[model samples]
Target: MANRLKRTSEGFISYRFAAIVIAALFFASLAGWIAQELVPPDFVERKAFYGESWRPGLARAVDLLRLHDPFHSLWYRFVLAFFFAVLVACNVSRFRRIALRSLRAELPAGAEELRKRPLSFDLSWRSLAAGPRGDADPLVRYGELHGRREAVDPAALEGFFARVSALLKRRGLRVVSDRADGVIRFTASSGRLRSPGTMLLHAGIVVITIGGLIGSLFGWRGMVYLKAGETAPLPPDSAAVLRVDEFRIVTGHGGAIRSYVSTVTILGTRGETLAAGSIEVNRPLGYKGVNIHQSSYTMGEGEFARASVSYRLRGETGRRTVELRGTASAVLGDGAAVVTALRFLPDFRMGPEGAFSASPFPANPALEVEVSAAGGAQRGWLFLRHPDFNARFAAGIDLALDGVEPVYYTGLELSSNPGAPVLMAGFAAATIGLIFMYFCNPRVIRGIATREGLIAAGVESRWKASFELEFAGIREAIRREFDESG
Candidate 1:
């Protein structure tokens, strides 16, 4: 029963289980992107684009699944949570094994165990005395005496163990030795932090997952539009106010829009400035944990529009121009008549009820004006594209909308995530862990040193081919030392 339970526990935390959970999370995220980003929100728009055949059923399914906000949906969150749990379990299980292996020193009990190692060699006084025959090839020389055991000189055995320890120490390994049952054992290692570095990488991933959960649960995002000097309250229960100080559309050489820039200020509830800066495309302003980005811009409406009106006395060829901003009034032609600009509309249209703007784009600009004279007051709409429509409004005055320049309002997207700093810290930790794990080489060498012979084995965490050559060098050096001692 205990063995069954252990097997079940191991299977639950295995890499296969973790990979399955990761795949589920990936599909969930993909579904979220398709629903929220690719699909239109309006049912009519969706029907128009995707065809009306499958619209109703698809829309109903999307709504039922809450696919419009999948990241925040219960099912998506559940999947993510499950993945996180699996990752934590796997990391914990692996970490225990790695820690035990890396922190403690263990040696083979006897010659049989040492011989089973991939890079193992046995040397005796007789083998060292024989040495290499011709070119002194380390690989060939070690291969010749790998498993042979012969009687050894006690003094020579002591000298050989001491010399091997010194050589490993010079190569930056921490060496430890033990003596038991008429045999001396030695273990040496380098890059002890490599295992811990791997664990740090796993820990960083766990931290990043936690940070993402925090952000997904508590963060908020919204958009606000503000003209110059206009202020709007920040969204999602924030007491701060976001004010647009200025907005400009930077144009390139051919009069194409290069970028949209907005100079803005963040004010506290008490109207004190909390932060202030300029934000353009790809540049965002950060205040506390909130980020404000310049998203878009549109032609301003109402009081933000400036209009130029040209007027003349009836049947007169000469005309006079008066500048009018919003509903401000200006006298025309020797102050005989007053013209008040009541409203301005971009993309103007007349509906069943009255005049209105179809859209914010300046496709068909129009200006509403009220002309007052000694006879009476007449109100009329002057179309900038068609001056003839304004002819019959007043008896003795001619009015025309000569030109209209639009002021632009900046569109800004604001988002706040309390876990952003934590996420950044996780990324930094993961980067350091990667550098340590990849750039540093960790290796271990173990051997049984006895009066009869020596059996040594070495292994590297990576680059097995290179470490094999290094191990051969160590064997050759030991052979040379014994030869000199002789």
Candidate 2:
């Protein structure tokens, strides 16, 4: 053991790498926090809008957390990497020590080494069954109100010497052959003699950590929404294409809006169909490694009344301004998909007795539209629920349904976390191991016997108040066995 300890002192066991790594992490975290505070933000406010910015009514949002990206920061990664390294090194350092201390190790050649450890017992078995029965003194019967019990009662120890010796010999109780020794040594530690629970806990942590590393290396996560008729691309690792066939919001029994359901079709990268599923609030669509969430829906209807145009065709291009209600004719030539502010609904609603009326969420939707150019009062009052709302407007041109804007699902978030499996496995293993270690029950007996009239002795049990209960139980069992046997 001295030599082993000496050898272990060479590397991690003595060098204290864990302490060093922890200190490094402490400093690194501090430095990162300071740097984050000291450095001026590398950001431009009110910058020109890019393809990622700008919305209908809201202004473009400024990106803040992106600057110096704390999570992706170099210092943060260095600290985490160093900490993980220390954990692995610590485990490796202890692995050798753990292997050397196995339960299969043989008992020492001399009990002297064990004797110095506060373990001693002077027990004799003789006072059983009024006398010894050749080599079977303890193996006798006792009186039972129902049936006799054939148990070893040691109260007959005095007359059962020869039989006791034989029993001990059969049990492999070896008396030492050392220098004039007649004392016998019995080593029996109840409950758990070998405690390896801590080692198992350490190993469980290692597995969980390694699993976390695997998940971090290979896990892919992203979110997408499929509005009606729209196709969305999967993440970099996905092989499927998702299309939202139809999305609708259905309220509860009393129109409480229980949830919004979306019918989605999963298409392979090569345009082949793979799967179809419906997703709703709280219920997400999962396929392979991707998850599609039913985020939101919107519906608005208006006519193709007035159209905004590039003045370039009208011999004016740079002169752009907000088109006021009723008199704005910046038209595009040759009639492409015309861009026009057909009409606007501040408070829109759709249901029975629902329309763009004066009442809030109007009972009847109205279209105040104007033609784009050189034409009569031919416009569109495209009803959201009813596609035939085209006829409800000023007539001339047949109002054909070019396209109706659907509702948008907002704040839809998605991501895949593989760490869940690892965490769950670790928790389960620890719970089961602990239960096995502490819950198993054990029983033991002790007695003394004499010739004339033997006296009952004691017993013991684990997992409760042991001493008194064990003695009482042994006395009763002895009395009952004697009564029944006679």
Task: Please give the range of 10 consecutive residues that has the lowest summed lDDT in model 2.
Answer: 175-184
The 10-residue segment with the lowest total lDDT in model 1 = 43-52
Q: lDDT, candidate 2, residue 437?
A: 47
- Candidate 1 lDDT, 90-165, residue by residue in tens: 8888988778877887766777777888898877655566565422756545655464346566676777788878
Model 2, 219-272: lDDT tens per residue?
766555444677877665566667778766677787777877788788997888
**True-vs-predicted CA distance for residue 110, candidate 1, Å:** 2.9
How well does candidate 1 match the true structure, expressed as C-alpha RMSD? 5.7
TM-score of every candidate: 0.72, 0.45
Q: Could you tell me which residue pairs clash in candidate 1? A: none
